[model samples]
Target: METNFAELVDAEFALEPGITYLNTASLGIGPQRAAAALHHGADAWTSGRSTFAEAEAAVDSVRRAYARLTNVPPDRVAVGSTVSAHVGLIAAALPEGAEVLIADDDFASLVTPFATRHDVKLRSVPLERLADAVRPGTDLVAVSAVQSVDGRTADLTALRHAAEAAGARVLLDATQAAGWLPLQADGFDYVVCGAYKWLLCPRGVSLLTVREGSEDGISPHFAGWYNADDIWADLYGPIPEGSLASSARRFDSAPSYLPYLGAARSLALVEELGIDAIRAHDVALAERFHAGLASLGLDAPSRGSAIVAVPGLGRLAAPLADAGIFVATRGGRLRAAFHLYNGTADVDRLLDAVAGRL
Candidate 1:
């Protein structure tokens, strides 16, 4: 597996020489297969060889791929433009003055829609306490499966039990966890993920999976012709309600075609590698990084996550970026993430550089 991981970096990705990217948690490096799809699709469009049906085909392919990866039925997944837009449907459905429980530092896209609603009341807690914080009268619990800030993963099983006991619904944002983590989207009332970060697609692609019957009370306010039961016939309304899709497609945000075209191939790559393989590969690299940090007398959280954070080391972000080592700084921590394309060498390079500075 280690030998294969090293070969994959040169074969799959188009990263430049001297660049060591450890920021899959921020923006992923898409494989060449996916990049080629984008270029080819754009060229076809420019030459008038591409039809709208081709774009629809791309979206359908991606929808199916993501559903398979997350263990959900394809019809249960909703393709969309961004996480915020997908969450809007849920936020709009909340009754007046209902309380929503959320992790305080969760990505803004997951929190903003609900926070902006003056009619909804939000209670924020530390990620570790979020599940236990669920109480009676809490209408919903929203959280990330793997935290974006420092890769602290939520215990969704605990959260699920808490929500069930309280009669609240679960909204899981797997934006940072999806590609490398095993997920069963059926466990959550709704699952939302942005593709650019870990799923390795263009920025415009995102996904929302609705557990069957969970969306009945939610409005499909953003529904457009592309996701309508009949794209051509449903273009303009006084469109009968029957024109809406019989499943979660009714809640889909109109997809951006070219991105979905790229997404289809990138997602195929993920399936080819398989999540369990990717997770093993990624977590090993992270543990290697953690071990290296300990040898250097550096402090970091060791959560067995693909993403790692070095506390109070954010000053290194600028220097690392300058040295062609890409990473992110969040909450006074220097964040680094490992993926299937990374190996021990990348981890060692980061440690050597940090050792020099210290």
Candidate 2:
């Protein structure tokens, strides 16, 4: 009945009382329903009365839910425990002996997969150099919409065009940028992100969206029984030829059904809020967090649309924890992230905690 996009959004999620959680960037605290869903799923798995058919159905629900969220076909959205797992799949699928272009400031998780591959040559190009990085032989141009640490949003339009001109594919690691910007999966051949962050899902569930025609020639190295279209093949015979489903389902590697079910419930909640509303909500919260950090004389390096990074604020990390404020300090900065569920009280609590520590 909630038609208004603004009214449809609810910030009051079931979270622990007396704890100001501001680190949604690292790990999202799920709504009470997501936790409840996980409990029920575990109960089902443990109960001898339940069948594997039921569990598989739950996994399909997740695929459908995430497909709606990312605006891709359910068949194209593969489930993964971590973004790196899916990234490894992409790296393995790249044309043999083709160069993969990565950003100089991309997350290490995104970079490590390409760098470790012997067949793929990794070139860590600066954001400014991205336009020039694409060449005739380039296979993939991979970068995050926003730099994870510094919050630098790159020119996706330009990057997309550049890659297309060179007959290369584009991959976006939207782990940090998904909930903050308009995610256009049109230009990208592949897009992967973990759900625990802005999507407000529990950890261990990641989403990958591949454009309809983009995955035509790619083959998944991480295949399982579920990847086969005739999973219930008692009628058809054992692993029929060409039985593997098309789209992203072909990449499913017996994903943890329990976590996927939990993630599905959480993503359903995100759909109720709608991504555009979430983006506006998160950016506003980040602005408030940036202001709060400034008031406390702490410097937020790379304060962008999603995160507020306070460099050398590790000293404040423990103190803030002692004061009942939860945040993450990584890479030499105290990191505070906000989502739709966080409010001014949360921001003020963090500011006051830092002030008290000082």
Candidate 3:
């Protein structure tokens, strides 16, 4: 059965009329449920209805939602403010003198944390060469599940096998692949994502998952009140030997209240719509967009993923924006990402604009 994605989610987004939004890779258009949740959070704060328990519950709700989406246990999910923040925590938790492997095109957040560490050694390899790059002494291998610039999806299963053979761990940045892609949470030892993009939520909330037994030797680099078993009790007395929360909750850092409320609602909406349906819908739109661009004598790197990267269109982003079509430019390619709210009309408009410009 053909999916009527427009009927399912178009009404829930606030995209402006005549403006085609294709920059979901850069940031997603906030859904109505997230906006309503944010409003409710504001009301609770202003009406004196907010409490510590309420805030903790909101955080737990968001964590559980992510856990469900990734098919991991709730205790394995750790909520953070951003992907970079969680990646930083992971970097800090690594053993001294650890060696890390990353791709040359990885987002700076993944590279910068380890790059700056004097005790850690960093190696950069091309995306296609990542599997071969894994070897003994490589403590961690990190890469995005989907490359942001070229729209290439990584084979996590293969990477996991290579990492395991080398006695290394895998960290996957699912910022570009999480909501619309079917992610197997067990494939990677660590998974991190920012909620603002494919998750269709506001910024300031991210989901981080640590595989079972993966947190064994890693200590929380940035511990806070929430990381403790009981904040008041810990504060009032000498900290007990095992006062920290037993699960990944020990790594939790406090985030702004508003984003969690909205994040919970955004996750609920995705679950309601069904992620498999969402992935199929996005792939169909992306294939149509690829075919349309091909007819216009333009070429894209890949066709099945949510992102379509047009060669040489990076320089035309401003012109496209002026035409009321939005996209992002990275690695000298124009990246147009399709989401549930996008339709055939948006693809037609993009193709027509590029054709007229050419």
Candidate 4:
């Protein structure tokens, strides 16, 4: 049976004629309409046509669009630059003198912010030991839903139960898993992701979700005027009392208006095409790539997400590069990540390029 990948691609985006874009988890190729939206917003800013009203609408639209994608209430999502930017918000929300629990191979962005804090103790545990590693005084249990390098998917529901049992809040760095898996809103206290990876928006823009009631005692470290509910305030006056929107909006600083507009356009396009349909298409394409690589006698590791890793053929870099193939390597494995934009042709080309080197 021919998988539904081609139909899904045809419905959403047409490829750039001859480019085989299979590294989407590294940086997604944004949709053409989204690129146009970004350019239009940039042109407005450059020409002095940018207005407060337009910026406000664009920011709100992007936040709501990300909220819908993550299955959360619209008010609970915030806008940010990258996944790391929002992790600072999570680190601040954590109780003082608290310890954070994380898997050993989690993305560094998720752990680096907490590591810099002297008051918060960092606890790094193995992925296999995470369920048993939660301690009594852990204030926040931090983890990546999918490891960016290895593509190992953590069981969020299980981790949530363990953390809640230990009286700890759950912070999920889901950049690698967003758009590839179905995320349940209630399963996390906080979650953050960059749209560049799989959502195919611009690189700097990201999404953050902080569950209602879970963020009661938290405050934004980097406060701004737009963080206020009555955002249209005269800057000439004394800083108004900080009623920071009482939701996830409290966490965001005033972001540049253009990327948010582009992100909203891209997110809306994805939703109209259907997220589930996108996941199904990508999953099948990944499977095809894996099978073809195996037939070429390359041994790739079995991971439950969109990324596949195989041992690099003993420094087989120049040969593959000469053949016009691109992939990343970590822990002795060459990594190939795919999104809905890729198809069988990209996979076959990769296999042909790497066959002899391995």
Instruction: Please report the candidate that would top lDDT against the real structure.
Output: 1
Task: Report the lDDT tens digits of candidate 4 across residue range 1-358.
Answer: 1345455456557665555656676778777778888888889889999887886787788888778878998988888787787888777766778888888977888999899888888999887678678879888888888777667778776787788798888888778887777777557888888878787788778888888887764567776776776666634454455555777777786776777778888888777666677777677777887788767765565445788777655255445555566566666667778777776788878777677555
lDDT digits (tens) for residues 99-156 of candidate 2:
9888886898788888878877888878878878799988888898877776667788
Q: 1-358 in candidate 3: lDDT tens per residue?
A: 2445556585688777889999999998888988987888899899998777777777878898889899999999988888888888888888778999999888887778878788998899988889889999999998998988888887677788899899999889999998999888877889999889998888999888999888863568677676787766676544554998888888788778888888888888888888898898899889998888878777887667999998877988999999889998988898899998888888888888888888
Clashing pairs in 1: none
User: Mind giving the per-residue lDDT tens digits that candidate 1 earns over 1-358?
Assistant: 6466557556888778899999999898888988899999999989999988889899999999999999999999999989999999999999999999999788999999999999899999998898899999999999999988899899899999999999999999999999999999999899999999888999899999999979875788766676678778767765567888888988888888999999999899888778898899899999999988989888687468999999999889999899988889999999999998787889999998888777
| Candidate 3 weakest lDDT stretch, 10 residues | 1-10
How many times do residue backbones clash in model 2? 2
Deviating ranges (above 4 Å) for candidate 2: 1-12, 234-241, 295-304
lDDT score, candidate 4, position 276:
78
TM-score of each: 0.97, 0.89, 0.95, 0.91
Q: How many residue pairs clash in all the candidates, one count each?
A: 0, 2, 0, 0
Between prediction 3 and prediction 4, the one with superior lDDT is 3
**Which candidate comes out best when scored by TM-score?**
1
| TM-score for predicted model 1 compared with the true structure | 0.97
RMSD in Å for all candidates: 1.3, 2.9, 1.7, 2.6
